[model samples]
Target chain A: MTGQDFPEPGPFATLSGAEVDLGRLRLRLVAEAERESLLDVVYRTVDAPVGRLLLAATRRGLVRVAYEVEGHDTVLATLAERISPRILKAGGRLDTVAGQLDDYFSRARSGFEVDLDLRLASRFRLTVLEHLREIPYGSTASYAAVAALAGSPRAVRAVGTACATNPLPIVVPCHRVVRSDGGIGRYVGGDDAKRALLRLEGAI
Target chain B: MGREPFEVVVERYGPMVLRVCWAVVGPTLAEDAWSETFLAALRAYPQLAPDSNVEAWLVTIARNKAIDQLRAQSRRPAPTERLPESIRWEEPDAGLDLWDALRRLPRKQRETVAYHYLAGLPYPEVARLLGGNPASARRAGADGIASLRNMLAPSAREKGPR
Candidate 1:
């Protein structure tokens, strides 16, 4: 058919109409998934004292906290691969955790009240993460101290690894894991983010 | 290159997929088909080649899901006609009329038109999704557009300037 045979705006344009914005439809779909509990992973970015933080959660609880330096898109891909691939960028499911985080960042709250979903960690690493949470909001634990607390004293190096790979960093308080020399050590969120978190918590 | 996040895929192709689904299944079941299409696409996303035509990929998935919906609908006992409680067409003025016209087209013509025109796939890609050769697909699309033009002409003349 020639162009003249078709409607002025074309059938596709007419059908699209002015009201059916697909971006809004997609957002509604994500909201519907969140309401239906079909969203395997829901994430949103939060601007914290330490720069943009990528917060992701499952129905289980808060699962990951990532730094901007970690590459938000790359981190999301990793989550999609490791978890089920059903991931969406919807923040409705993260309201509770985001609120807690906002409070923590502003120093209105000293600790997080949100549930932690540590399914991304396992075995000794899981043990290390569990210990990392107990490091307290304003205290510091040496890697050796964390290793001992996780019940593997000689696994200080493993403790460092666990700290580096901690899925929920700020919420789980991996920044509280310091070097034995009383120095702030390397962090998954980079040293700057770790320092910012430390400074925010008055641990510096 | 590694696969981009599935969220990117959804955002990029969601409207095209929704439009194709609406054309194939009508508004009542289009939402379900769209959801299933994206969910299935998400499941299979990592396996998708990085350089694949993502639009075409989504349209193919949407077509399959819409067909499945049609099959399920056909299997169900027909209910008496009643006003739907919720109609999702944002533009009530003309979208429903277009949908009615679309639903009346021959299945092949309808699928071809939706895939080629709405989803923006070339005839070759549309043929790959709908089967048969590109020439037949092109012919079907032309026939579909002609049919729509005829169907809408009287309304256009009656409505005049709007």
Candidate 2:
């Protein structure tokens, strides 16, 4: 049966008994939110794509994409304490990147085309992601092709590692980079998730 | 606000964040969003206004975080054009089974439902939260519900929602 309901919100007490379930669900969400803050108390937010991300910048360029929800100072403290002690917030470094991202989810864009501040990633990985960003929408490549493009023709496995470690995926389009012969290939987000993404994009 | 036991906050609001996240970004992204939401809350707990509605405030943060996740995921190359597969949408269920179903919806549609149903926010509020107009919020809500009904309904021979 359809899950549609009458115009008004359903009468929970009058409907099937799911109050306890609903209550439990609410409790869980609150718990998770609390736990998240605790973790950020230590680690500094990085552009490395941790939890949720908010991309922002000064007119100079994209600044940073915060993984944790605390203020910039809280994030900065963690960054200074852990990860790398050296951190700077360059302006406008991520504006184009953020705008492209906003356009993409609005369904106004099919793919990303922008210059990413991949300094967060290593040189080799940055090169690999650079090639990934060029992958046409709805198409895919192989580990070998990526390796070759990154100037490591024989490092297909290394290419796979790069893809696996990519701090940026969709921006780099690693999903579009697949097995040498066929098949979707391994993804950190899981095969079903990878396949689901492909299906959503009509790539599969 | 007095520092309520962290356990009390968790027991009361954990799943709300989870559902809102799952509704907005789907299962794949919800897990991290869920973790991140609490992490943010914990750090901000000391700063929360004493008079603030903790639920709404937390939901707002969670909503913002979820939106950010959706946006970030878009930049990462995925095989699909649709950010979230429609197959992920499902009615909220007991044991939080509804999360998997809600995950099937597109980020926009799923978000409409989450803000409206789970967070209990009005269309206008949902609009503000989503960076859209009230009309858009209404339309997105309607479209999401319609999609959910269709998705949850049985095969052609089965009975439909009354």
Candidate 3:
């Protein structure tokens, strides 16, 4: 019997399941974990004009944003593999970035004002992202122009690679880097999305 | 690469840990024990062996944290006997109240039951934690479980026919 005494020395006191508010208990655990710096990564997803965007951050700041096309689950698994496996889906560190993105998509904000963690980018790509951010809102820059601004005038192909592989996407303004002939370049968020972002900025 | 995210670990075992903690320390301090247990687990998760039995490991940590909480509690103003029986942690039960009956067991018997039955520690291991021998630990566990069944099970049998 489920509640019968353990003739073989089993425990009977836990016959009933505990009455626990798991959601509330998890909130408390997360709060304490965050306080102790045990929460290595906190991520959240936000609905943006491009699609549902997955946002991940460390205590360092905003790190990676993945498009709906990129597969959000894949992004999180890679984040867990590359970064600490201590990742959790919490929104405490991501609220500011999500709000900034909302403003950017609405054309109310011209620039992002959140700290960024660019650890996912290599040295040359870091240079490329730095130049991409200076491309300004409501404007477009040729990949060649971006390469030159990054102090690698002959590295136009590399600039395109950097833009395609940019981890921060919209926050880093990689969408503004277009083909020199004004053909919308290949984009991580796809051609239609790049065009939409340019249109949102009044650049098209 | 096979290491699970700490978030999964928490989700998989958080409830069970809370139950054991509630059993050991009661409702008032169970959350604190749970918080300490998981936070400690998080701090040391990276070094935890991938092939380890995470449930047993967590229970071991929970035992230590629960003991620490009890030790700290012992220094505080002792709670007098909970008379009038008005404050029931598990409420609305027409049958036997497990928390009420559990509170009547000796401290050693209570711990023996939790470690042996709930945490899945073997009797020898439970005895080691209790600073007693295996036979004594086994007896305490038997006593605790028997007391619970005697108190709670008859109600279940009688209610079944009605």
Candidate 4:
């Protein structure tokens, strides 16, 4: 056959494209199977009174808890870029955390016992998050109070910054940090979600 | 050395591995082989040498997975008169019929063609995968492509430059 018979660039390229799409679909199944062992991060969604929550974990522990308002896809993309990109939607590794969240949302659990992987948060933000956990199950603390607890009383706005970027919002109890003026401040899960958690805790 | 995220590996080599598997196993078991290959690769990715040719590595895994599938099929009892629906290629698209043409080639020719043409591997690498020297592998690939060209020419003329 003449060289021209091969067709410039040929049918192979077109076929490869279709094959790749099919491969991606098949990879989803494999990803489901290997998620626990191979994926750097595994995530699953749970329905709650606030909204859908996107729970993601690393091998270390729970890394992120995202509210629906944050856009789960966007949150996942960020996680992929910032953390490892080996992310998959599989819930097996999260069974314990899922049960804990179910209990917390149902008002049957007052505190989370799950180990947290807070590597996603920076040093100062992590300090604020650590302080957030001490805000008590049924009480609120001001940003200034959290700042003081985090050992930088002058960094109240930075405390707000930490809360805004808190990776594990509900699990870390960032909802318990309120404005000093007796106003419910902005929450990662939104002010309404904060109120829902506080009311569930009987702190409202 | 810092390792890249495994997702990059998947995205980069996923198509190549799928095509290689399809060429080796045909459509019926190609997806399964592809998935198994990737899952295995993902499990071993962290320990992989940083300078390794990732595409070649994945293609090798895909070849092994396809062989495993073929072995398992051979062990299964002969089918009754009625063929299983899963074995049928459902004709998802026109280009998909390429698999039927691929299945007609002898094993060495098919492997060489897939590794060289489909996966875009060099002759030496294809030879290594197929357990032969580069010259023989190149010849096999050329012969396979010639046969395919002859078989597919009429259809290509009819389709008119797609």
* Best DockQ among the predictions, by candidate number: 3
Q: Which parts of model 4 have CA positions greater than 4 angstroms off?
A: A1-37, B1-19, B26-32, B43-101, B112-162
Candidate 3 clash pair list: none
Q: Please report, as a value between 0 and 1, the fraction of native contacts recovered by candidate 3.
A: 0.30
| lDDT tens digits by residue: candidate 3, A24-134 | 666777788898888888888999878899999988999899998998877877877777778777888999989989998887899989999998998999999988889
Best-to-worst TM-score order: 3, 1, 4, 2
Better of 1 and 4 by TM-score: 1
Per-prediction DockQ scores? 0.27, 0.05, 0.33, 0.22
1 or 3, greater by DockQ:
3
Give TM-score, chain B, model 2. Answer: 0.70
Give model 4's docking category. incorrect
lDDT string for model 4 (A108-160, tens) is: 89898998999989899988998788888999999999989999999999999
Candidate 2 chain A, which ten residues in sequence have the lowest lDDT sum? Answer: A11-20
Q: Write the per-residue lDDT of candidate 4 for residues B1-162, one digit (tens) a residue.
A: 344556556667766777677778776677678778878887776677778888888888888999998788679874432211222233465355576567778989988788877777788888898887988987898788887776567676477443
Which candidate wins on lDDT?
1
The sequence of per-residue lDDT tens digits that candidate 2 reaches over residues B106-146 is 77777777777776677777788777898888888888767
Q: Is the docking of candidate 2 incorrect, acceptable, medium or high quality?
A: incorrect
What local lDDT score does residue B116 receive in model 3, on the 0 to 100 scale?
A: 69
lDDT values of the candidates?
Answer: 0.80, 0.58, 0.79, 0.77
Best by TM-score: 3
Query: CA shift at B152, candidate 1, in angstroms?
Result: 5.8
- Which sections of candidate 1 miss by over 4 Å? A1-11, A15-20, A27-37, A152-154, B1-4, B25-33, B39-57, B64-104, B128-131, B147-162
